[model samples]
Target: MPNCHCFWSHIWNISGGVGEMGANMNSIIEEERVRGGVFKDINPEDEDQQPTVIESLCMNCYENGSTRLLFTKIPFFKEIIISSFTCPHCNWTNTEIQSAGRIQEQGVLYTLQVKTKEDMNREVVKSDSASTRIPQLDFEIPAFTQKGSLSTIEGLLDRAVAGLEQDQPIRKATDPAVAEKIEEFIERLKKLKKVEEEFTLIIDDPSGNSFIENPSAPQKDTALTVTHYKRTPEHNAVLGIEEEEDDRKPVNDLDTMRNEVLVFNTNCPECNAPANTNMKLVQIPHFKEVIIMATNCDSCRHRTNEVKSGGATEELGTRITLHLTDPSDMSRDLLKSETCSVLIPELEFELGMAALGGKFTTLEGLLKDIKDLIVSKNPFMCGDSSTADRAGKLELFGQKIDKIIAGEMDVHVILDDPAGNSYLQNVYAPDPDPEMKIEKYTRTFEQNEDLGLNDMKTEGYAEK
Candidate 1:
């Protein structure tokens, strides 16, 4: 392809209201928007006025055809370029969507529960970089395997099923056993389309542009969960990002990163893919400093982050509690150390120390993670090993956790760290938050043993 004008740059400059027109950029763009809406196809009736229709060589028939490019912006999102190629001679056609802006800073994960046929009607903007999966069926649609599409959820399934069935006839003639297994699997997928049972649909997009429509609008959709997190080195590679030597250096100490973040290159344990690890040292109010380490892996779509106390272990353990009296409290930042125990006295629920490893997330996010790990990731959900009674109980537990995350239930969240390394954000820094409490207690000998403090000698052993 020949080099052309930078599409995004042109859009930005035009929107900036520059050039001889001397007209307000917003006014000009708004006029075009109201007239053209989001996108428009080249109308054959306006042959003389069509700007995007250009003669192109068709790959299928090696004949001249036409390609049209449409530039538009999604409401509340970024600018995008849409292209369509048509070959009338061979009846071959293709459409693709690309983001005109730079790659997003974070990747996105969307989980939707397809419980009813109506859920399949949701609009989906799936970029080529997005991966789709159904956890129940253990089926996946790999990223970049197909071109991008602006289609509905049902349409996506149809496309995937069609692709899988395309080569089955040839395989059946060549290998009977493999074909039989695939035929069985395809039948299962067909059953899924009929909504035989509820299944979870996950869209993992490292580019952060893919979207699943929400009919609820401003209201929260209980059936869908969306999470945005830092991207990995592999993701950057996929997006054609250049790497620097400084990204691999571990010389950056706690103090250096406080001023500016330092990213380090690492390998993901899950897929051995190039990943990115980040460390930040944060000072807690009326408390000591702690280090938060995060890692992202694009290959396996795994996100891992941990938090450790920056300061030396204190003589006494620490316990922190916050009363969730309002919905805003769910947005507060929380740090749970490797040795922290979580509890909700009102819900009669408790998570043992280090059960979830270390995490630094919001109250709502942590609760949702707990629910997802227990319910959707449960191995029993995959086969007949699980009884309906057991599944119902787990479902109820997830609902209760969701209610807590939604701030519909008033409760006290407690964090107890035997190492005294955990911290919770204080909205009122100078003053005490009305519904929060902190206390220190001497660690029990058992707790010390569990923390490996029993073999430690804080004082000098050189005399020995």
Candidate 2:
């Protein structure tokens, strides 16, 4: 029987019919592992079980609504989208947490992080992860007792004190860490003052705007009283004391100041090639209004706004008065909407006339509004020949308009032509009577004699 069993087992192995047997052995091993609580394989009966998915919540304890949310799944790890989160109530976002990965078949998953929250006088930090938010951690900021003035901490005390006169020195006494030193100095001063009356020189830092009121005065301990003294011309004008003028470094046109140029590129609704659009505005100083301008592509005539935040140092005076001007600055109201209209009533015009249009009001105000619009557009027109021509024509018109405003020339009124003949004609009107032009006379200098020199030798020789 034993020989027969061995023969049957050898036949089964040789025929490759031992699949279930090996699986059964693995199952037994897995069972043993499960009994030891270390098994991770799924049973045949539990094959329908799905991986767990969890949604990450904001770690901020005091507030809700985060732009970041992560969907994590166990079993098979995966990742999804990373997006911005903002609180609906306070519009505050949890910048600490970020979307790390996404779980398969589940929602997006985000990485956990710590966040800061301020309550009354305390700031709290909390660590949180997807599906689990931890308690806020309590911490304290150590108070400093170092003795120094505000300028000292700001690294300007030495330079400021150096500029003060010897008779009047600027002294700064900060916290009580230097209390003993201050007391010793005070005692020495008192003794010296008793020996020499009026010999006590009170030193003050002219450059230092703050003052240390009574270092030993307990009643005014909490009170940080500071006196700001303006730099007087008389004080700075003293002999041998040259007030150092701040050397303002020259600013680069392209690099200086803060100006952001955003080029919005899109195809023209009409022609789908390349289109640049922007709406730029000059933040006029002390003015509540902004100027808007736009430009269009030359190829397709596709119009769009070009915006630029360019900083100009030019001084813009207030629009204090607006009265009647000339007809040079007036223009027809072409605005499609009343909201786009900027014509003010009883304002001056470029033509040295008051704007009394068919319906519009002041043309100067309207011109200003147009200027604002043009600036807002900041349109980067194509460098095509056609665009260049258009830009040239526009520039010519601008020059002519400026001349008209300066009362140097008049804007010739002409019928509109599709060929842009009117712009050219208005831009360049040749003098009809060229022959009637005035000619400037010049002295026919006969070498040095034509200079009209009153030489004594020449006069005597001529008389002789």
Predicted model with the maximum lDDT = 1
Q: Tell me each candidate's TM-score.
A: 0.47, 0.20
Model 2 regions more than 4 Å off: 1-129, 132-258, 269-274, 279-281, 289-464
lDDT of each: 0.77, 0.29
Question: Which portions of model 1 show Cα errors greater than 4 Å?
Answer: 1-51, 244-464
Q: lDDT score, residue 11, model 1?
A: 27
lDDT of 2 by residue, 147-243 (tens): 1121111122122223232223223344344555444544543443233322211213332211222222344322223233454554344212364
In candidate 2, where is summed lDDT lowest over 10 consecutive residues?
418-427
Instruction: Give candidate 2's error at residue 456 in angstroms.
Output: 93
Per-residue lDDT tens digits of candidate 1, residues 218-267?
A: 56889989999898889988977776763564556555667666688999
